[model samples]
Target: MIEKYEDLNESYVTAGAGKDSTSIFYWGGYGTDQTGITNYDKVDGSDIRGYLKPESGSYNGTPNLSANITAWTNGALSDWNGKANSNVLKGVTTGDGPYTSYATIGHVLNTFLASADAKGYDDWYIPSCAQLALIFMNLTSVNNALSAIGGQQLSPSKAYWVSSEFDSNNGHRVYFKDGSVNGSSKGSRYSVRFIRDI
Candidate 1:
């Protein structure tokens, strides 16, 4: 019995896994236009981000971390979230992705996305670096929906956080401006785009 949530601006398909199975959707937040905005939507506290994971294997068949890092920074990386997550895929489900509960916005993002009643689904999880890259590729469609709903647009050249953690202190941040995935401190402020399983 998955909970169903809808609102004047509920963006379900965008948040859920894509029909391509290789892509993921970007759920829009309450923005200036109010597209897909839901009352259940909540952003994390200011300056409250944290690490996503300590270590990850590789993206798809490319075990070379350097190559994978180079891919996203150039353009959006498109790999099936399920098919390509050979290295970063973890079993952490709703209420279980974070090392702790409600300690930071990063944890909250994982927990909420897992249990969130978006389009009557509740199997969301934090996306690995590769998965995030797919979302980056689909940002145009995503941003359009957000703009229609008066939501914020993801800046083209800004660093957006991915769930890939390089170490205890750092997680991956994808540069939407370029497509480069770089490791940064978890506490550093950046935009979050949480992708769930289809």
Candidate 2:
């Protein structure tokens, strides 16, 4: 059965709660009020900082190696607001449309949206280059939690797409294998994963 966001409990909500069936991988806590406070330790839900990565199956589907970023707006090059980028690429429509037959940003965005909908949430979006770097920084802990839950761990051998665009013809991607960040042709296909704010 599909797991709903509400089904997650405190264990999953708190930052660095631990690895268990009920615990979700917490990246870190950031103060939502822009208080410039970032707590790497466990924090309660009241804190404005926290990011939750769903199970691998929930976001990472078959690698759409053919997916390109140039098929849609390149204006989503923000280093932080991936949701906005996704929204712009998806247009104002409620479902998939206007995407080319070949895998593209629109296709990937729609795929993520469908997964989010299945989880009874609608805020999931592609991670920006900065967000992807954050994930890389905490790869060990994230992988541990994923392993504990029988979820697929991030592969070091592959590069993953980010929402940041290098230009109209190129976009940024993170190489997990070596933690290298670079911009490549928008036509290049790479792995994708979605993240949501807590």
Mind giving the per-residue lDDT tens digits that candidate 1 earns over 1-198? 111222222232332222221112121110111212111110111111211111232232212233333333321222233223212322222112232211232333333444433444445444555566555656677677767776566667566655444443444566666555555544454555444544
| Candidate number with greatest TM-score | 2
- Against the true structure, candidate 2 reaches a TM-score of 0.54
Query: lDDT per prediction?
Result: 0.38, 0.45
Clashing pairs in 2: 30-49
Off by over 4 Å in 1: 1-105, 110-120, 145-152
> Global lDDT for candidate 1?
0.38
- Model 2: runs farther than 4 Å from truth? 1-78, 92-101, 115-117
Candidate 2 accuracy as lDDT: 0.45
In model 1, the worst 10-residue window by lDDT is 37-46
lDDT of 2 by residue, 99-118 (tens): 22234443444544555333
**TM-score of each candidate structure, all chains considered together:** 0.43, 0.54
